[model samples]
Target: MKTLTVPDETPVFPLRWVVATNDEAAPLVIRLMLALVLFPHGAQKLFGWFGGYGFDGTMQYFTETVNLPYLLALSIILIEFLSPFLLVAGLFTRVVGVLISLLFTGIILTAHVAIGFFMNWNGSQPGEGYEYHLLIVAMAVSLLISGGGKLSLDSKLAK
Candidate 1:
């Protein structure tokens, strides 16, 4: 004689809907590689370690020497520093991938494209070429497609 009520099965958090699978191995590899490369580069810019110019010096180079706007330099610095941190943690994988891709695009357009696609094999070139940026873009695109892989915080968080 009593009416029955059913409970909703929907999850409260969005990340819960995106379940990680064993197929994430490739993404994991890509993420790890990106983290390894980016972290030290970022450290150089932000902290002056590894022979990098510190924040102010990097800002001057990026803004004055490179002719980038002040805000753009700051954005580049923040993205370089923060993206690697979040990427290593595997948090917001897609967003981080996009940011990294964008940064590489800017680098290619501003600095490397004119030098051509290959590395300066003889070390006589004034600047490096676009090969490394191309590799980063490829890896970033892969991460964007696959999301963070196994052993990532993103995978754990989804659970």
Candidate 2:
């Protein structure tokens, strides 16, 4: 029987680079704010908290009403529901940011664009607008650029 030898060279995973963060307070504030704001929304979708539809209802709306594919609808629900905790821990900040940005962008294009830029604060419009989504996108983009800062897991991981 012939023995196979392993190569001496091994690939390096850039985990540090991915999780790298600075000690700035700005990112920490932004990250916390984003997470806090999103957590309730997530809770609504996942657990029916805060007047949300919960998983089955949300899935139904996304699939039947929105005409989204099952996998994509599931992904949106999971991301919204789970990402807040990850964001709070400051884990995979950039990746989360990208996911949020893409999710909101999709929402804007699919649901909110026709309603225009302002939210339905007065209930004057038939639906809400894209302004809130735009703000979320802006926050996500900031995290993508800055990472989780200060006392974040990403900061510790970087060091």
lDDT of 2 by residue, 31-128 (tens): 88898999998888888999999999999999999899999999998888788888889998988999999999999998999999999999999999
- lDDT (10s digit) by residue, model 1, range 1-159: 333333665444444424332445788888888988988888889889899998999999988898889998888888888887777778888788888999999899988999898899999888899999999999988887777887777777665
Least accurate 10 contiguous residues by lDDT in model 1: 13-22
Best by TM-score: 2
The TM-scores, one per candidate, come to 0.85, 0.89
Displacement of residue 46 (Cα, Å) in model 2 is 1.0
TM-score of model 1 relative to the true fold?
0.85
